[model samples]
Target: MYIPFDEMVDTSRVWIYQADKQLSTAEQSQIESKCNSFLQEWAAHGQALKSSFQIIHDKFLVISVDESFNQASGCSIDASVALVKNLEQELGINFFDRTKICFLVNGEIVEIPLNGIKSEVKNGNIKSDTLTFNNLVSDIRSFQTDWKVEAKNSWLKRYFQ
Candidate 1:
């Protein structure tokens, strides 16, 4: 069912989707409603899935499922992707663009194309200590502790060296 994100266990499976741009207040509200409805009806093999979601920095959508309750089947996973695809169509936002990298700059979220990372680093716009959003985290505990990490400590470290 639709559990509050805070109530979900730390080991819950997570998927983070970064929007190409920040979502407006209205867009966030619409997304919240749509997600809540989806989670309410989300099931795997007819068993309800305990899930919750968080919209972070108006740019990332973090979805979590307590798989200990019931493992998510391939079909259920596909359904979640479908929901994201529908939202992309409705909002004209690209949520699957892995080429756009996110970073925290002066307390604001900034996106740099993956190809531009080297130049940004060379220009000093991106530093080893810059906070980067690592969307590859696979579970809630890692999402909580490692999602936002310093560039030197993340996969982005290669750019620095």
Candidate 2:
């Protein structure tokens, strides 16, 4: 069921949820507890799924499953989504919005609206070397290595070009 995040292999499947705004300390604690409780009972086709989660920079929630043990079925995946939805409502946080781009600036998390990215880049706020969170990484290995990447190396590279 629930395992320490570090115990999951590098090949584990990863799902990243970005919060529209940074979470307060209380919210983070509440989220961690709720996730731990839900993951303990999370299963796929009645089989317990080995999984873990990480909350990064108070702005991202990463859930990973060691699919080698038991692949997450469609229903199981839906269950996880439902959990996120409920949390969103209860916490008044938006985790499903993909229209904001997150970047690490001076050790702070800065969010730029997707439609305003080009303008921000033009304003010299986002540079070719700006570290942006690539939430699209699908596995633990990539999540560790490429989750935070330079803007020029990410899909935003097109804008740089």
TM-score, one value per model:
0.98, 0.98
Taking the tens digit of each residue's C-alpha lDDT, what string does model 1 give over 30-139?
Answer: 89999999999999999999999999999999999999999999999999999998999999999999988999999999999989999999999999999999899999
The number of the candidate with the highest TM-score is 1
TM-score of 1: 0.98
**Model 2 lDDT per residue over 1-161, tens place:** 89999999999999999999899999999999999999999999999999999899999999999999999999999999999999899999999999999999999999999999999999999999999999999999999999999999999998888
Q: Which regions of candidate 1 are displaced past 4 Å?
A: none
| Alpha-carbon local distance difference test for all models | 0.95, 0.95
Steric clash pairs (candidate 1):
none
